[model samples]
Target: MFDTPQSTRSGATAPPPASHPTLPADRPGPHSKRLGYIAVIATFGGLLFGYDTGVINGALEPMRDDLGLTATMEGFVVSVLIFGAAIGALIGGRMADSQGRRRNILMLATIFMVGTLGCVLAPTWETLGVFRFILGLAVGGASATVPVYLAEMAPVERRGSIVTRNEVMIVSGQFAAFVINAIIFNIWGEHDSVWRYMLLVALAPAIGLFVGMLRMPESPRWLSSQGRDDEALEVLRQVRSPERAEAELAEVHALALEEKESQTGGWSDLATPWIRRLIIVGIGIGVFSQLSGINVIMYYGTQLLENAGFSSNGAILANTANGLFSVLGVTVGILMMNKFNRRAMIITGYTLTTTFHLLVGIFALAMPDNSLKPYVIMGLVIGFVFSMQALIGPLTWLLLSEIFPLKIRSFAMGVSVFTLWIANSIVAFGFPPTVSALGISSTFFVFAALGVLAIIFMWRMAPETRGRTLEQFEDDFRIQHS
Candidate 1:
């Protein structure tokens, strides 16, 4: 068989394609700055996504008290939104294809507003759950659309870093949630509805995203696919230097033409062995990311810490550290994206995370159930978050965005992310019961086991996309399986 495309080659790979033009380090270019502006605007969706999901971490206990939630009901409260998110991801992909990335984000922002409003106004547990599910539609849509939007808008050479910015924003949003939750809780001190204030804080970012995205350009790749070549070129020129814009537009347009010529049907095209293989890889990556059980810390950190023996106030305060370290980790991960191999970094993350998982379990099993135990376990949890955010979290989204053929990219992302949310929903819903039955030590052991399987999956199926053009990856997929 022909040598695998140099871009995806394991070692001694060729450099990035020429279409990914670079400016001198001494001086920043207008084009890069413009691209940065667009990225910042689009990633507000990620901020909203993060805040909406994470606000519940600290808010849940108060909500439980307000709504009189039982353990099963609490699980339902958390997991139901994730289930809604799965549907949102499914629909968001198709919407991105039909509605345009810009429009879909605008719509998601509106959904965010509506969801937040509903939650804030929710007077009963049933209504609160309904609104959380509504909020999840926006969260899931943003999750499905934002990365794909960034990937499509980005320069081929800068794709990894640019797309991963959304990941950073996601973590940043979570950090913001934790900080706000702490502030509100500390100030209000067991007020019956403190969670409402926390939920309401999300409205600011939702409004910002809606307003900011109005001025953002449509994805050039999406435009090309729609036969709007002139519009596509204009969007490219706004984000790229004149020469590079022309060149990249040519590449995108040619791929668009090829897609049109193929006459392949959507969804059914996935049945082909090669496309099926890609979906499997995509789904595997998506599922594995969640199975890492990082959300245990993200969603129910307070409960976990309380279980480990911290008081309620102590748990929320300590959870802020988790949020802080998460931002630091994702920031480091973003900086490292251009500097390391994707597969190696992700595998290392998995290895480290799995080790931490086992260590946490081992400590839980061995430690006395005393004051010292929570601190030690918290340290382990912090390390796990650091490792996860730095590697698998960002890399998983980046891979999912780039892995599929462009023709079905959004749809495939939806499907992949839908599977991811499904996994997330299962974990979120099951965690309380699992922890109740399995105990914290046993719970982490299960996660560690999943991490081991994740390593195997990455080794066997994950492709290296760094330094490769999306077009090149597309070509590689076709050449290898055709």
Candidate 2:
């Protein structure tokens, strides 16, 4: 086991590989300035990812009305996209490896555009589902590709901040979706077909990503891996000082040579007990991440609030608060990252979120039929979202990145995130009928119970990975598990 570069939006646990050469620090030269511009352009993929997923929060109601969807159909409509995402994520990771990161991203952008156009013009729910599945392919692809592109392109010292840009853009994009939904719903509240306009919002960034990436250079590390040292050095020099670019190429070249000896592992690696255990841990982390019920709010928050007591317009507007608090949570989470132990943050996060979930269920069931009941429940749900995004949400990705050894790191991360999406699909698909049969109060009670289970899982199974260097952590992990 060896260290690999992996981190969450917080950029925690982002130490460069010990086996690689030291990278140059970020400089204030023209090349560096241009590099910042390039990063901004590239992370448009993340922005599109957030909007496409979130626009459905408010759009689902209108979409169902226009398409005349049944409750079960509603569940499948939402779940199918996630199922596609699961497969897309795995395929996208491999594409990133075999194809250049830049090429994969460019292709994903086109898919995003096509998916957006299809959804906007979809005449039937079945047609909508097919296009949504196509969009999921793009979403999952961007998820797997964009961060790697950023990490590889960024200066070693600035990788944390640069890679983190995509995450910030993601949350901000969700907020944008909510805001746009509210505005559109308010101005055109009478229209039954307003949802088409909501989904159309994603097309802009998808176009931006495609256009902007045409000017971007290929990843230097990837170039080196493919035996194109001259091309790699040229790309690096455009983004770094000439001397730094030359030095980094030698290191990248050396690392590329080392990789040939330990080529990425396959199914046989899973036969090894230690690797298998960590793989289970990786998948478990993904499972717990979704079982926390965060996406229930993300995908269904507008409808959830409508059930709680808000009017159609009020619900659409109020859901913006969830999006807003998410941005806030990610902000605070980033600040807390440097200070808190990741495992401790996760445990405490689960506890707080569980408490909030319990409160939401309790208030919904026990509160008198009054306006106050909705407000009280709304506050509690916000608490859940904030605590989730602040700790468990980002930490889920971080832990996935941290747990796997270098040899199979990409494979494991892809598998785990795929599980996360499947878990998400299961929850998303079941949520509507569960609410129909059990009501929102009981449904939340179910989530609360699941939250308790997630807490237990983290306590017993999660690794304490804070403060230690990645090599030491992986070594200790291997020995302890063995």
Candidate 3:
């Protein structure tokens, strides 16, 4: 068993805590305001992530017409970004680990800008798909890195809320896309190429993230891992209260020093029992989060509305409600993250979302040809959005950020989110065809069944990370291995 600063299962000497110099009573150190600034900047990556992915929902119709896309081709276009995101999550995690979190996000900003421009300017379907994949790289990178950055930087007590703020932004971005799509489509709905304007909206935020992150401090936990404790402490001083900063740094320093003896930040480390178990849980969180079928609503809300018998314009406009409530749900999620148990919230969300899915499916099946089906389906869709964003959506990203040990946090997160993207890709690619074959009722029923399985997994496997330090979680896992 490895020794840690805290008492081990095998009764070893607990290392003494680090000494910190006291400051004057009048001198206040860092506060939540600075942290909030950092969060705002970092979550821009999330915002861009949301807008880029969500833009496709409304743009797909115009894109299909302009590009003469078959149903298969449209699905391919939508799913390709997810497939690229899978690759991005994998690569971005490793990059964040080796290159530092701040540096990686800056890089992602550049990629977002270039990829967005490429997509906006693409002259052919092949080119658009390729650029979307490029944008996927930025999206995946942001997904893996931003939450880790926020989680590592945030105080333990407030970590859930702070990290999950990115979810709020992500949904907010999607909301913005829906609103923009509605306005743009209303004005230019007759034009086959109006989608280009929608795609261009993301470019400004990419630039903002790139510039804003330049002034932000590096993640103290990451610096600690790199043997830059002094730098880490300084960064902590910028974001946390003086006492809290010292305490957090103390924990980070201890872990960093202990792990210094033997580096542990790669795929090979997964061979050990505890690390393997942790990653499996991580993978489960990632997979089940997507399996909740939230993205079906996200990526195909307009199409789903149209399928339910709304006209094209009616469907696009109705999606605005989806976007609005998603923002509301995530806002509620941000408020509740600090108050609720992570596992309980996720389970509750999955259960409710699954029920909603079943209801939507059953309703659609019962009234498959009724004139009222569209309105009823719209209400159910709104219910699904509320259920998902408030719980499963925010909590998924929160848990993924909090679950892994710092040593392998980024790498493990990459794999977990990679799994998420894969599940997402499968759902995205399959949904078009599935809906085509089985109709709305059966499609949602399939999602509802998956949601049932997600609840069981959350109940049995997911950890409670509500009130613990990164080092505390690491020590607990190490003790389990011992």
Candidate 4:
């Protein structure tokens, strides 16, 4: 079995406590304000992630008018970014592990800016696809890196809420995109090329991430992993209460020392039984989160609205409600993360979302083609979005950040999120055509079926990751699988 701290052993047989990461009593105190600052800056990675992906939802129609896009081309445009993200998640995870999280994020920020500029200026649909892929790399990198940075910087107890701050930003970014797209489309609906303006908004956050990260501290856990214990503790003191910093450092130092002897973080480590199980869990979380058919809505909500009978302008405006409620969902989600059990929350979310998907299908199938159909589905879609953002969405990222040991955390996360992107790619590429050929009712039924599989997999395979240190959780996995 892998090594574990003494205090965590009592948790082995019982389902993990509360599903929230709270520090031991003595370790809680007056943390530095820098913790809040760091969360804001680093999570811009998420904001950009949201804005870039969500922008395309409203832009696709105008781009089709200008570029003469076939349905296949539209699917390709959306899925290419996701495919690039799969590659990025893989590469970025390795980079975060080897290059240091702060350094990796700075590099990603630069890529985000360059990629955004490239997409904005692309002369053709083909050119736009290439730049979108580049931007995907940055999004994937940020997804794998930022949460790790936040989790490592935070006090043990605060890890749940702090790490999840990125999820809130991601949805908020999407919300901003929807709002911006609506406003711009309303003001400039006559222009075929106005999609460029919609995409341009992403540049602001990409720049913010680059500038803010320059002044931020490197992750203390990452420093210690590199045999820089003194530097790790120094970084820790910036965000933590002095006494808590010292205490956390001792724990971090012990874990780092042990990791150096035992781990060589790479794909080969998958041979280890516990690590393999953990990787499977991570990948499942990523895959199922998307299988909830959430991104399909994020990517195609305006189209779906149009399909249901709204005009171009009306659909774009209606889609903003989805964005607004997602932001609201994440707000409530962050607050609830402090108290809930992770497994229970996810399971409940899955049940409700699956039911909602089924309802959308039924409503689309049974409700006569009329004005009321669109609003009813929109209301249900809003509920589905809320359950996803509030219940399963943030925790997906939080559990990923919390469950893995420090050495392999990013690598495992990269692999998992890679699958997430790939799954999303399938949905993106498949959704438009599916909806076109089969109509909305059958398309949603397919998603509902997929949701059932995700619920089963999560119920049986996913772990509860609350109320523990990184070292403690790793040890439990090791022991459980041993």
Best by TM-score: 1
Give the CA lDDT, 0 to 100, for residue 6 in model 2. 44
Those runs of model 1 whose alpha carbons end farther than 4 Å from true positions after fitting are 1-28
What TM-score against the true fold does each predicted structure earn? 0.94, 0.85, 0.92, 0.93
Would you list the clashing residue pairs of candidate 4?
21-157, 22-157, 23-157
User: Best lDDT goes to which candidate?
Assistant: 1
Expressed as tens digits, the lDDT of each residue in 391-418 for candidate 3 is 8899999989988888899999999999
Higher-lDDT candidate among 2 and 4?
4
The alpha-carbon lDDT assigned to residue 193 of candidate 1 equals 91
Q: Give per-model CA RMSD.
A: 3.2, 4.8, 5.3, 4.0
lDDT of 2 by residue, 1-482 (tens): 11223443334453443223344454578998878988899989989878988888778888888999997777667777788788877788778777788999999999999999998999899999999999999888787677767767866445544665676677788899989988898898689889998998898899999999999999887788788999999998899888788877886677577656864655678977878988888888889888888888888888899899988777866788999998888777766654555667788888988889889888888888897878888899999999998877767755664566545655666777788888988888778789999998899889889889988887777776544333345666777667
lDDT of 2 at 18: 25
| lDDT pick, better of 3 and 4 | 3
Per-residue lDDT of 216-276 in model 1, one digit per residue for the tens? 9999999999999999999988888787778788888888998997753368877678888
Q: What overall lDDT goes with each candidate model?
A: 0.87, 0.78, 0.86, 0.84
Q: What does the lDDT read for residue 150 in candidate 2?
A: 77
Please identify which of the two predictions, 1 or 2, would achieve the higher lDDT against the true structure: 1
